[model samples]
Target: MTWTDATLEDLVLLQRGFDITKAEQRDGQIPVISSSGVQSYHNVAKVKGPGVIVGRKGSVGTVYYCETDYWPHDTTLWSKDLKGNDAKFVAYFLRTLNLDRFDTGNSNPTLNRNHIHGQPIKKPDLPTQQRIASILSAYDDLIENNRRRITLLEQAARLLYREWFVHLRFPGHETAKIVDGLPEGWTHCSFAQMAQYLNGFAFKPRHLGENGLPIVKIPELKAGILEKTPRYEGSEVPDKYLLNDGDLIFSWSGTLAVDFWNSGAAYLNQHLFKVTPSVGFSAAFLLVAIRECMPVFMGKAVGATMKHIRRSALDEVMHLLPQGHILADFNHRASELYDQVQLLRAQNQKLTRARDLLLPRLMDGRIPV
Candidate 1:
């Protein structure tokens, strides 16, 4: 195996992506690669498969490796030419470059191709690059497998929830009587009746720090973990604003979503509600109930700029309360599945940390392949 020293521009051609508006985006399987990974799916692909993308604007230096054909959004710079370099190897190499340091903008960080083009880079021969990528991809493949398993487990649990609650086909349902389109003892009640929504605190920008309590925002809620959220260093942070693992959080403002806070201790930011289920209502039940209400909440959301769900909307949302024994049974069964999901998520976090630590070292030849 051999290596050669060269500039980035010599190894690949970087071209700005095309502008695709949200209105024009049709739903399909082709990923829409933005500055921060796949943002959405589009029917048409702007770039071919086995491509590498670099964040040129908002999320500067972020790199993505797409195995399938994708539509790279205008906010990114996609590789128009690899110049015979291994695509996956290029992705890894870019990560080792610390492209963030090449930001050309002061206020809003941005990456300019011309600036990065001149930077020196070390490249290994095709076979050696393949070997390095294979080692790293093995970890990625395992992570992906775990993710699929987690999704399946979650789906199975959700299916059981629907079968028992939505379809009214629980154990011994043959003798159960129905009234008002519900099981004999089941009652339709407002969300407020079953759960208490502790709205997050408003933390000012000045109070934020590099090291402190992670802020759980809407994005964090969507991702089921905190990523790139700001942190706050305040001993005065009220107990109500602090979060715990397994806590059910609902993003009531922008992009309404219900998720478990599997990530460790964090501060709950405004527009999010840390929901605590009342007696007889299990966290599992609350999660499903809130998820069922998402469509209705989204429909009622109002905003000229960014749509948001109001507290009033959540207050009006209804849940079908099951009998005590039935709710307990469901919680007992689903809790195991939820625990597995959390375990898998935690495992992925660890795998990610290990892979990330190995990435730069392997790419820079600090750790041999």
Candidate 2:
């Protein structure tokens, strides 16, 4: 399946996204796009779907294909004149192409319709295009399914954590004494009392390295796991900030989130909060507890420019600290469920990585699909 003598102009490029000014917008039925992608929204006056979209400026080269009707903005370019190219196949091809190579010199890099129109593409015949698209689409479909499965597993874990820990409905609760209407041995304590918390010191962004220990950031602490582990110099991170396996990292700012680090030494920046379970405490259980209490603590935190969570203030936010026997019993019961969720998540990560690694090679015909 070797492609020869292929030119990009052979495949038509459509650059007709309506440019609607903010003031001119009045519940219009279209989405305004600029070279940077979708800039604003308008009511849909017309509809087009199952086409490819690429950013024409600023953040150029990013590509997306849609199967449902979408209004693209003037900043973006929509491929309507596909010229017999499979929309998905074109997206894959665009992704492989370095659109930045065609950038016009400007403060912000940009690519216009003419630039893409003149670019070259090494492509095969229609049947080959369909086969290539089908192979890549299968990988995407599997990756998407894994994403949904991860969400469901996380939701199930969160729900169970809430029911058993937050609601104090653990087994044998009927026999436990009722003290102040709460479960017999349960006692509420502040986050400071239950866990040791610390925030990492500021390190120069340039001090970061690509292959050292992970420097967990706010973005890494989403969906209860670490999605990336971009590294940093061991020196930039103080020993105090360095984390051991089983440490829980919490982001106290926007969209409050948490992640568990079960890997090698890693550190955090000033924006992240690290929590180590107190001696004799269950780290897994505490991870869930922190997630449960985050909403309450985040609501009380104050700042206009950026939300702040004072260590002193966090020390005051309360949580129920159940007595020893009950705590151990709850952990024992929930242990299997948590373990299963973690296993599934690990497998999903592997699948996602495999798919991503295969994408470019498959689309470029380096690997036969």
Candidate 3:
């Protein structure tokens, strides 16, 4: 296959996205795409899909591909003309440009469409483009499938938790008597009593390095997966700050969330807590308990801009503790479900690494399609 050098403007049309405020957005199926990805959903769509979206501001140079009709926000630029080019291939090709370098402003990073339109890029003929896209897309499809499976497994486990604990409908519930809206053997207890929250070490910026331990931050917790985490020098990292797989970590500041640390050995950063279950509780139970208490925690969080939960919040949050036998049974069942999620997540991490390694090689013709 032969490749030709061509400018992006020669192959496609770039147009600014529409503006839609949060107040105007209504709940629906159509995704409202921003520079970072889908910000929300709306009932209406301005652009039809299989379309490619490029970040124009804020998160400059980021690229997103939507397979369904979507609403592109003003912070992005979407393709208006493919000119017989493969849409999937265009998406892959865009990533190779490292578009972030073309930032037009000094302070607020921005991508000027005019600059990117004229930028030179090398691409193969349509058939080869499609072939390359197909190969790379296969990996993404597998990753997406694993994500769906993980969601289903989590849902089933959460439903079981609600049935056995919340609804007081455990296996032998028929024989148990209800008192004060609680199952006969269950007792109310504070979260602090069931688990211990270890705050992360405060590492200065100068302490970070290009190699050694990766630092898990609020962004990692929100994504539910860790990638491109900044590294900290091993010598500077304390023993207590190190993390292990399946450990539950909660972000107390900025977007409160709870997730298991599936990513291999890393250091927990400040504003996060490495939650360790006490003798009577399990990681699975603690995860659900923290998730259920999120609304209350959010309400109590104090801050004008970035809300933060105080240490006192943990003491105030309450949970119903089941008897040892019942709790053990619940843990046994939920642990199996959570273990599967961790396995799937680990598989996705490998798949992502493989895809990233292959993307540039495939795009540059180092790996022929």
Per candidate, the number of residue pairs that clash is 0, 18, 0
Q: What is the RMSD, in Å, between candidate 3 and the native fold over all Cα? A: 1.8
TM-score for candidate 3: 0.95
As for lDDT, the candidate ahead, 1 or 2, is 1
Instruction: Arrange candidates by TM-score, descending.
Output: 3, 1, 2
Whole-model Cα lDDT of every candidate shown, in order? 0.85, 0.70, 0.88
lDDT of 2 at 15: 76
For every candidate in turn, the CA RMSD to the true structure comes to: 2.9, 4.8, 1.8
Q: Give the TM-score (vs. native) of candidate 1.
A: 0.87
- Candidate 1, residues 1-369, lDDT tens digits: the string is 676898898777898888999899998999999898988898999889899999988999899999999998888899999999889988888887888888998888899988888788877788888999998888899899999999898888889888887887898788989887777898878888888898898888787878888888988877645446788887868887899888999888867888898888988999889999888777877787678667877888999888887778756877676778888998888888888888998898888889989898877778865
lDDT for each residue of candidate 3 in 28-143, tens digit (9 for 90 to 100): 99999999999899999998898999999999988888889999899999999888888898888888788889999789898899987887878689999899999999999999
| Candidate scoring better on TM-score of 1 and 2 | 1
lDDT of 2 by residue, 1-369 (tens): 657556776765667565567887666545555555555666664447778877766667768777767766665678868888778888878877767677785897777677567666677767777888887787778767766876776677678777777776766766888879787777877777767778866877686667677776675565322434557765645688887655678787765777665444667766787887776566666767777777677878888888867777667778776778867765665555556656655666676667668777876678874
| Candidate closest to the true structure, highest lDDT | 3
Best by TM-score: 3
Output the better candidate (2/3) by lDDT: 3
Tell me how candidate 3 scores on lDDT. Answer: 0.88
Candidate 1: residue 282 Cα off by (Å): 1.8
- Residue 12 deviation, candidate 2, in Å? 5.3
**lDDT (0-100) at residue 56 of candidate 2?**
69
